[model samples]
Target: MTASTSTVARTATPRGSILKQRVRWGLDHALPRTVMSYAARKGDLPGRLIVESGNVETADLVDLFDAARADGPLHRGRFSFTTASQVTVKEILTSPDFRTGIVRAGGPLAGLREWADIDILGPLSAPSLLVTEPPDHTRYRKLVTRVFTVRAVEQLRGRTEQIANDLLDKLDPSSPVDLVENYCARLPLTVITEILGVEASDQERVLTFGTAAAPSLDLGLSWHTFVGVEAALQDFDAWLTDHMDHLRAHPGDNLMSKLVAATEDGVGLNDAELKATAGLVLAAGFETTVNLLGNAIALFDKHPDQLARLRAEPGLWSNAVDEVLRIDPPVLLTGRMAVRDTTVAGMRVPEGAIVSTLLAGANRDPEVFTDPNAFDVARPNAAEHMSFSAGRHYCLGASLARMEGEVGLRVLYDRFPGLALQPGAERRPTRILRGYDKLPARLS
Candidate 1:
């Protein structure tokens, strides 16, 4: 479908259709216990997210990316509330001039403060590593590195593999299972919580908060999601603060304890940064990793030959992980702003303009990768994909995420060699973050 046609159809969706969609969304999207119980008792669904979810679909993502690439390496567009100029090339993503520190006080995001609950822009709230630019960004990132170093994450591999296997082992072999909820979602969530030293009793509560807060990142949020997000954020902040406080007094080997012990330039993270950083680590740690596992399985189900190839060469599991990531990245799009009038992929970007770096598009750039559309597990250059992003703002948990993906997919395929997609698997209605909400599968 044409872009105009897709836009018109999306804008013209009827209220009844939207209501039904929201109902289905509620069932599919995880919610905190408080919200779920309230929803059940009050018969009030989570408020509808009013923002326009992006138009791209999993099947059509590559084409859309290709079109954006054809528009030039830098294509200007408006995505919901922000004027987005998407950069669809590797060169731009790696450029040092483009930065995440664009959203400032009195900027477009700050103007939406009254709509803060629903606006859900991270920079509008506080300075975390994700939204801040240099100096502050440098400071926060340095302190974060002290906790999430490559060696630190590599140390989690054994436990990550164990978590993946444990979740897979619990699945019933005789019946169709929702790989997302049963396996994919549980693994990363468990691992992250374990890493953070969340009490076993409170882990479920944290997951609920994480689920409630997720919709805020969608760019388009309904009043329902806003309310849920506001409540969840407040509660989650408090929960994290309490946890950090405990870690401060009673240190352990967990990451939170390390964060508490960490200092940069002889300065420890203050109260606010401590809470914000902890929240970011917890939320991001599982969100994309869950999608990575789900998307990998979904893609493998689509290309049995690739799956067979990986199964035959067990050593290729790591390469397969990268291929799956390149094929269907969990985090599809991220934004950077030209710090000054800068040239990205030869396009002049004005200072303060938001460039929505299409990592999904960059991954499939035909100019960069051979047969970019094909899902080839052995593709040598697959690791070059921008799925984990590039440059200074690269994902801090990337190594950990990669380990989880490789181990998770390997264990799943090994445990259920005859696994096949069961009918009725459904993709989540999201563009920025793509993954299966329900990947039904029969483990033979």
Candidate 2:
């Protein structure tokens, strides 16, 4: 199907029933215990279920991150009203419905227009290639195949390592440091910016804009946060347009240049599409990796023995990263709109229903993983973790993210043999991305 046809079809689809189901499910599965019980007694389904239940709010990215940090895999009240709307879709993604791809047919975003503000031009509209069935997914995957090839990512390993080391060099062990601000945040930002051929001065600006842009998918124009987001999008569009123009005139050896050179059946990414793709790559490539690194460090600190094991057997770094991601994926939920009626985990979901898979929950499902709560670097099936997700929509930067984690950890341990968490470092009050806002440690 052509993009124009898909766009027209998506807009024309009726979503009243799907919206009702979403509201119903939000109330049923997302409400606080007392509130839900009260509603149950009153027989008011909608009344019983709160739109932003404090218990299952994973709605806000920050709250979701905090909840994951405080409570391992599945935690109730992870999202407060303030945060739920943002992460509601992600919460659903972690649920069992996602694994079956039934939700993908008619995912949540389709029905969420009433609840959230989503940009139709974004990946949300890109047929659930990540979660959809094989043939279509395979075809879509092929289109972008060159972008995420293992060799494509591996080519940047040397540069990634250099970026990691450079960030580490800036660490001042004397004073309390927010690892997220300094290293965790900086490493991926630098790497991704480099990949996009963004200049050093523009790295932080681009990242700030990218981060703001991500939450805009749900926060919309009403949320104060989105004010910055809108501005960021405008800024990013301008920046990318200029950058792509430059690359068009003066091609170089970079991802942006390659993308500019790439063509599909003699059709290439137009200016707007190029900007969107660049924005997506910048946001995902940086923000998620920052969270992943921070979470990994926090987990290592929490499990000294596991850290010790890794220190002894550096090879375990790969499995260790996987285990950490399984326990606390950087991205908690991914959204999809159901294209048709589907049943998941015995729940009869109607067509156009918003399907959310809680990836963290799915990763921790006892049926799928043994001792799901434990942080075992040696778990034989650690690589089987769905932190990067499975199927078509899998993260394109999985390899690069892993390389950064492995190299970062290896360097961290080697440098600070006696690194220990500071006496008190408060975590940031967000849930969607798990990591310490300030991780102060003494690096001896």
Tell me the deviation in Å of residue 353 in model 2.
1.3
RMSD of model 1, in Å? 9.8
Q: Tens-digit lDDT track for model 1 on 253-278?
A: 78877887788667988877777777
Lowest lDDT sum, 10 consecutive residues, model 2, at 1-10
What's the TM-score of each model vs. the native? 0.81, 0.72
lDDT of each: 0.67, 0.57
Residue lDDT tens for model 2, 1-444: 111111110111122454553442342233333553564366432222232322232223333333433433322231211112213323444343333222212234444433432223343223323333455445444555566678988888887778777777888877666676778878888888888888788776776665565544331123344344445656666666687787788877778777777777776665655655666677668778887888788788889999889878888888898988888777655445445565543345555454334566556655567876678998988776667755546688898899888887777778778877776665543333445556777776
Candidate 2's C-alpha runs over 4 A off are 1-119, 123-141, 217-222, 423-430
